[model samples]
Target chain A: MKRSFYLKIFLFVVLLFSSALADAAEVYYLGGPQGSSQEAAVNPSYSLKQRFQDLFSSLSSIRKDPEASGSISGHLSQTVVHNDIGGNREKSYLKPGVNYITDLNFSIQEKLHADYNFTGQWFLRKTDDPRVESRRDVRLKQVDLQVANERNLYQFGDFYGSFSQFVLGSSLEGFNMDINPTDDQHYQIVIARRNEADTVANSFQRNVFGFKADRYLFKGSDLFSDFRIGVQAASSQDDSASLPDNHTAKDLRNTVFGLDGEIVFKQGLSIQYEYAGSAYVEDEDASEKTTTYANAFRFQPSMRLGKANVRYLYYYAQPKFYTDAGSSMSDKIQNQVSLDYRFSDRVNVTVSENYYWDHLKGSSRTKRTFNDEKYMTWNLLPLASRRSFNLRPYVNYQVRNSDDPGNSAESTTLTGGFDISDRLNAHTNWGVGYECRSFIDRVTRSNSEIFHRIRFNWAQDMMLWARRLYYAITPNVDIRHRKGNDNKDVTVGAGFNVQYDLFQRVFLRMGNTLADTNSASPSGDYVNNRGFWEVDFLVDKERSAHFIIRGERNNYTAENGAQSYKEQRVIAKFEVNF
Target chain B: MRTKTIIAVLLTSMIVVGCRAVTGAVVDRRAVAQESLFSLAGTLIKDLFDNYQDFSMESFRAKVAVDFVSSRNDLVNNAASNIRAAKVLDIDFSLDQVLSDKDLLMVDLKWQKRTRPYDSSNVVLTEGFTQAVFKNVAGQWLLYQINKDNPF
Candidate 1:
């Protein structure tokens, strides 16, 4: 009797909440790395991310004017993660990290054309334990400030609107140094629970200050056109201190200056130019200088045809003295041209080409003793062709010239893809490239590769009372051939991911991938299999408050050996934006 | 489960058939309207560029400046919106007739337009445009393709 009564109450509450959601606006939330989202095994689920925005806006409106309405919003996201790998080695870790961001924003404007706006945000972050390397704890804190003054102007020839004709800004940021991920030698990546005494921790403090100014030259449509120019200056200070009180490092100072300008020609030819430079200073033994610059020009003769773009740039950097003694001074020049063509609604193509020439002058010690100086003389140029069909199918090809030393001897790559029917898609690519003459003699290598992929996708928004599921099957094969070597390898892989949205704000996802490779070995033949698994669960109360738990496991097995690794992480986030 | 699958397919087919009927009519209208717009915009641009001597930088600037001042006044008085000025102010210099076959028309347009600076006191122009296609639909003109470089 008690269980039945509880069940009845739950059903009633669910019905009431769902009815409320049916009347709210719909907004989809897409969160992923690198500004793009991946397809899931289940259909795309729509979340009420938009409803939150509408709710906030309405709340602000209700409290407007008489109340001078405003809202302070923030988000706190923290993750606890663990990783495990075994080989008779017992290792454990409890790494914890938290990122909290808060912003204060408000606006007050009168009937006048001028207004003042201010926005500020604070970001605080801390990492307690690092996995790849031994580290105790690190923290970073930063603050941003933005203020602008805008006014209505009738001086610009044909433009209409109020502009921020002038502005001023400054900021301060600092963080504790941690591990470097780009390039770490084998000696730096060791993590052993049994050897805690040999581990060391080091950290650094950094700060930066900056300022900027902008101004307009004239207004109105004239043969001379409208113009604007901006200038900025910034500087940073770095101080490092290692553990065990070994030594106190000198402060490193860096300064940068920049300038930018834009011009509109009466003939519709618009040109823009910008330049920036930086200088670094440290102890007499470890100081260096560097600079970078770029220029671009575009033209459109009429409205029907597209624009033609041309760009050129040069960059030079001199090697440092202490740690980079035998290094060389490097210089690089690049040129590019592109044209956009629109044939019709269903067809379009863009043609582009890029050429680069680089030179390195060996240092005195390297010039006399090292053979690298002879290898420094080289150039590289690549020609690219691209075409798009019906906005859904596309093809691209690239050819390279290799006589320039740094370039491949002769190489060509082609990729073509199409959507077959509504549920199937396929892509294929192949490339053949040769090693430069210099490397050909030593490595004696030429390479050929072929890749093919096909995927089938099916999704529906409505299924079994608002529940949605999306699924896809992707299979790919890659074949590689090498010269001077009788052995070759072919690899085939497939992956699938799916999300099942249950009720209003609860969901679960599961994904897996498998890869198999067949290789002709020096002794005979070999096969390797690699697979991975992923699972995640999430819940949101109001779209602004959320909780997520995710885990991944990967395994690799071969005829001779096998290895398995796993990771688990959980994150809780909440925010309210106005 | 098999019955459910059949029902789902039947429902989707019904919806698709309904959509197709409506789309068929729209396609015909769009085809004609797009053709007409393309022809008019293309021809105008080509004629302007062909007589570039009459529309030199000095003359063009003078005309735009005068027109801008008047438009600004009208906007302040709430008599007009910025769109009116934008339409009258669009100027293209690179004009080439690339397609005039069949009943459809296509042309490439490359032109530069000066924009009002954030301060409104200064003007900066950027040069850009597109090759556009037009089709006449239901006695109305519509645009199909618009790009900076020549498409066809």
Candidate 2:
């Protein structure tokens, strides 16, 4: 009788929550790295993050004053987390947290003549484990300051620079200056010490120094039509504790010279080209030395019609094109052609094809393992108003072909999806979507795959106080046919998530997902389930308090093998914004 | 053995470097928009050179500084936001026209932009047959308007 009485109270509390909805602000980003209930997974405490900003707002009247030309805004959060992962390698962790963090930007400016801006972030963090001293420290993530005007700009602190498409752009700490004596021409000088971000947890630090100069030449007169050219020379050296990597130690000194240009003959036509040559000198094993050279180049031409933009590109890079570390460019031979068009205000389409001739930096480049891909995609928007009937549709098709010397294969895929939404009233909304994908291969066309998915979403607001509710559910069906047999494999999945604002600043959220797979051949069968429950309470607009619990389970049985895996975790979080 | 070891190290380094490039691309896509906040003049240049991205129509329309023209020009704002990022640092530019006044100035420039990451070199070399009108507001120069110009 006593147990039954307690159950009645529990049921009553659940029934009360059935009428609530989650605060959209706290749950806007649901699918980031840590999955749902982000507060419990990534940041255990951010509600207190608001206190720092509140304290400073009063102190720095300059920050809040409307008359001031500059404004500063940022968020600070502190978290404590306890996590456990259950499986073959079971483990648990306890963290005490970051002492403080600041993502702040401050800027001051004068009239049209000049302005300066500074932005940076800092964090102080530590763990509860006393045995690991290295797990605790204060880290500075970013700091950049710039002063600029109409013709020239100077920058100091942390910044990235690149010359041409491939060479340069290593994150560094230093100074850069741009001089523009004329409107058509400019010169740039860069000097910096490469400050690698990964050095925070690693045993080795690379102290590389870099310097480069770039000159740009162009003419804008109709007599000359269109023209552009860029020339650059850069040098860098690795001046670090050259510790042995893979039982081999080497120090590198590299230099690169590059030139790139473009010319437009008419309104719709243009051509572009780029080339960079890199020379490397490596000193290894005390007295041994080796030298190598690499070259990179690209050529592209494009045309624009009334509704379409078309372009063709060819790129080539040798294995050793990168000196120390490159930012954007890669070592490969590639060719591509693409077109984009807008059929109407509500519809757009894009078609593209890409071919990769070789991966020069891979295990083998001379093997001639070539691959190509073609793609077409369309997007449409048919919505009349934010609260009226709305429709959105998307479709995509792609094909990939590969020739790896003696072996050849091809794959084709097509997918389409659409969402329809309607407003039932002033305070309620409903939406539904359906999507499907079909996949097939050329060599063994018998092995094919198809997938279908459907989802429903809704939100409601109650007139009583500031309360809201949101819910969504999705179901997926997948089928894959066997190549040699008439049998096939099938899997089905369904998941739902709900959020409720129980009070003025408190919320409750819960979600569950489950999937099952069955095979006619009896060699592949499995079931997977995952779920999470959470409660978040807001102290203010920028401060929140939260707790969460999560669990997952997977079981598989087949003629080839049988296995099971399961895990559970709990978290508490706080946040503050200033 | 030495040659093999060298090859392994080189391969590993390349993998790490390659991964960083792709990762940075993803990071840029996911970065908070606050860092790239709007400025009357910088917004246009920001869309052309530095980590270029489309701005909301409201922001573009409101930022249009030309008091004589319609600030809510959806076509201009849309076209401005649609400008693609340069593929490389290759740029050609020339100042073809400029009209100067005490409170306002109009200029016409032309150039070709390539596909590449944000860099000062590109900024210094960017080209397009662009018509930009600047106006002085409280002693600050703001991007007043932009118009299309014939390239040839």
Candidate 3:
């Protein structure tokens, strides 16, 4: 009985959203002057006749100089896939099935008057697959209708609404409007549904309403090239009526108010700041409800000094601060700074530091943890230079500490890597890289580990018999050593890939990889091989077909036991676009 | 188990029917072939720019991989902010080089953009060089990553 109630609510919401489509249809029908004469005769009203004649005259004018443009384009595709697994039913990864899919996109733009225009867009998709649930068979992904002029714009249906990072930023489906009455002033308002009710997930539908206003100044001043200030407000709530009886999520209500500003100077310096306060209630419909009021703020500044660029950031958020439509890291205070300096055209360096901590309220029962990270990068030659030789090296170090009575544990980690590439010629290139990482437990020295890795890559391009061919090979090795057990493990792997134009209309691509691992632990010792081959045939610009085959095998030899498994798959697909 | 068996039989029969239809069809030998891989990769980049200029978020979303990774770790928010910021007045790009490895392609390019902020009348010009990675997902090339900087 409860299920039926939820279903009714869901249907009602669907119908409510569908009203946008219905309105669009009505507009088109009423404007086309193609309505049946029988309706006019039945009405027999003078006003109806006069309206019909007016529409006819308007249609005649449109036919003379339409100033209208539209397009319809998309693709239809069919695919068949088969998968076979051996020795490991639990390891089956891919779903095997046949699928038929269709995608259609249409849009129309017409100039309604001197400085106004009407635009409409529709996107639809259909997928048929017996292996999947039926609920995903067809979907109307996005639809939008807009009426805009030089000073104002209004949108109905789906749109992405954003105000500020900490106030409201999310994709919504409903109505949105932007009013720009002058060059220095702007206003925006949005009312939309954030999420639809999900029966499988047992989650209630969510809705949001928001508005923002901005004022700009000092647009041409030398000291301040641009300065802007804005204020924003947003409220979001979950529909308790749409919640299923067995729902697993709490009904939430949240509202946020924010203020933000930005300043840009003529000397290549800029600063931005934002602050938001939120009031939230969880399980609003329940007797025992939880409520909280909190605030969050962020400040960022960047400057260019000589040949160096510097940037700094500071952020803080209370533990209970929450915004349903925005992003924030709660219960933490963070500070970060970075510098990028160019010594010369061929050399550059970057350095940065970050520090953050949680448990800002200082709860007695909870431990407060702090983290610090430092990083640096130096480049001998930039990658985009495409020089004969390019070298890049970087290092990172981190420290974590906690303040607790009996468990005051601390740890530190250091990591470093370097990459060097050489271009032998226009058609050939080779690169090599190495990395090392070490972790230490300051309180317990026994709990420590060190890891090292090395990799090499080579690529070549050629034209053989007037056909283009390209291939690449990469090999890598990794070693991990632990202090407690005095155990060391190593893994070695190599991969090769090749692409060739077999014919004017056909292309072939294939790749294979092999890996072997020797470990102190029995379960980790294994040898693996994987490969795939693909062929693509192009019938024309709008038609194509693809066939692919893949296979993988794994063998494990350890003191405990020996095991093996194999998997294979084949896929064929054809697609046409119109 | 009964449903699985029925679905298997239906799929097999459909495959058989499809094969017969394909065998009966005729091929057109004079039709134009697809463009080269290099040209195709370049065209994909151009299409990305056009979509951004036109503010076509749906088309832009279609060109991105489902498993896309970003250095900033916030693709959705970053994309939304970019889309809401300004209107592109002019754009110029050059594909400096391309590297192909089976199902993956790496492209290096330099681009310049001129944009007017939504609330201001002044135009801002910015230029940079970046590398982008594309992966072949079901015969469609989708953007996987932007190594250094993301213009959009």
Candidate 4:
């Protein structure tokens, strides 16, 4: 009777959000630990893998009732890893021990309008280590209740915000607002302790208050239409004053302010810009005040000319230009131009150029410049429609100058490759292709390299399983002359990959790569290379059960210690959903 | 030096414009606020990848105050000021996921950027995810915000 009552209650909750697909409340913020067993301790923010686990758990809960709205899911997964980084075979006791991980997620969302939600996770895992320390842990990954309406969003417990690029997007306990009083503008406000989500309290979990406002200007004007301008300000106080980084709470505070905008012309031209400035509170005993600034800018123009579309772009970013939430676009400037033309029936061409400069922040180091060129595959594609075989050929070239940013060294490379495939019967096909590349580098002058590769692949589709196999062979030579030294090196390699399925429930995948290098020199020269082989067998049944056995080997050889290794690993995993 | 560089660029642009005029193929395109959400979202990405101006690179960002963000253009120029020309590498614009409701459209995008540094000849690959949100305004969709949720 108790079991039936619980089931009925679950059904009632699911019925509440049955119509969620049509006009669902947004999940603007879902914050928790985002890391793997290998990365969780060091990563302060929740991980992507964790999010997927949470989603699957929610899905399981939804399966109970078609109209179910609550979030509760059970999960079980295990992985074991063995590694040996030391080269000594006799030291059996020193071999790395196995590592294991398992977790469970329970999430709930209760919404009459689903304008609000209560969701969290209970995660447990264990790590094995013979030398250092093993960890057996259980923690609340997150427990947060969220409420949202047309103009407001509120969350308690654990949450994060995505307000602006310069603003901290850190996980914390906070109240946030996504308020829109007027149609043309909106505002976001966040007040939380950054790094508070760390399983262990961080020494610098500062309390930060941030707000941002955006105003859309000139709703429908040609030049001004769709233009968005935003301003933001944030200040953080040393919430953990007892820590060493902020003893007495004097030297550990900061203020950030920024402005960003984009103006677009209907004529396929645009200008985008961002600026961020951060001021750090200085200790009373410090000698100088420290402040940092960063910026990003881009210009793009695109057009259709005759029968082709042409685009040109230039990008620039300052080194150390830090935005707490922005992608790293620092220390480099780049330019890209491309022209893609499609001719009536027999002709198609794509041409593009890319150039970049790195090390702009170095005061004394010269900058390095790179140039890349792509001339699209001259595929006799029309023949494919009228004939049994099609040919596609392409060229790639690159020129790099200096390891240092300036005129210290240079390297140039070019390649030409092609692919042609024949359609054999209804279920089988095979293709073969080859390419050659030449490279030359002159740090102090005198280096030459040439390489060639051949690739072939076959595939067949029949019964309930599809099978495919691909292989490639590559050979290369390199010669270097410096002052009184001369060295010659040659390398040969091959690779194979295969995939097959049996009974529609079992899958097999495998790949192998082998390479060898030979070097001769009067002064001193060494060659190094790596060979790898991996295979996996998976059994998946009706998406309910999954099992996989995987093994991998990495063998490395080198005359010099620059690179050398030999390692092997095997893994078995099983997963099921109820 | 900066002034000279700017002047040189302007001169080069004029020459290019003159050539386009001679061809009589220079067409005008405009994206006002009348576009739908999908069109508007696509334009935001297009503007971001195509614009070459330092300031134009910021065109896709919301036009509101974003405290302490270094202007993307300035950052680029600072990184490679001597570089007067550039070209984008293999970048694929894929809208991997989309969610929409009455007044909002949220999109998960995968942007693959392959490029050589302004002064180097080696390519660097920075692939990441960005979440973009669009809001409906007066029967038109406009980009409201962008967050870089890149996988580190």
Best by TM-score: 3
Query: What digit string (tens of lDDT, one per residue) describes model 4 on residues A188-272?
Result: 6677765442324444455777766566556668665467666665666655443554333344566666566666666655555
State which candidate has the highest lDDT: 3
**Per-candidate TM vs. native?**
0.45, 0.57, 0.68, 0.56
Clash pairs of candidate 3?
A: none
For candidate 2, the lDDT comes to: 0.47
By DockQ, is 2 or 4 better?
A: 4
lDDT agreement of model 3 with the native: 0.63
Candidate 4, DockQ score (0 to 1): 0.03
Q: Candidate 1, which CAPRI tier?
A: incorrect
DockQ preference between candidates 1 and 2, better one: 2
Give the per-residue lDDT of model 3 (tens digit) for A1-578: 53464345434433432333333334334442111122111111234454444434443231222322222223344555566666543333333444444444444444443244565666555655332224455667556677655445677876656688777755577887765433455567788888898777677889998877666666567799888877777889898778657677778899887878899998999998998888899878788887778889888899999999998888888888888886676888888898999999899898878788888883333888888878787878765556678887878787889887654658887777787889889999998877777778787886566767677889999998899999999887767676776556666778899999999878888887766666644354555566778887776643333333333332322222324445566666665544
Off by over 4 Å in 3: A1-68, A96-123, A128-136, A144-153, A244-249, A288-290, A362-365, A382-386, A406-409, A443-447, A542-564, B1-152
Q: What tens-digit string does per-residue lDDT give for candidate 2 at A1-578?
A: 53464345434433432221121112223322111221221111223345344434533442354323333544444444344444422111212232222223323321111122222322223434332223445434344555443334456765445455445544456776553322233345567765342333332334444333222233444533566665555666654463335423345577666666777765778888877777777653356676667788888888899999998877787877754534223456777787889998766777767667555664244455455555555555556354376665555455555556534556666656666777889777777766565666676776555545455656665544556777766565544444555654555667787788888767788887665656545444555566778887676653222333333232222233323334454555554444
CA lDDT, candidate 1, residue B26:
8
Enumerate clash totals for all models, in the order shown: 65, 35, 0, 98
Better of 1 and 2 by TM-score: 2
Poorest lDDT segment (10 consecutive residues) of candidate 3 chain A: A35-44
Model 4 has an lDDT value of 0.47
Cα lDDT of all candidates, in order? 0.32, 0.47, 0.63, 0.47
**Model 4: reference contacts kept, as a fraction:** 0.01
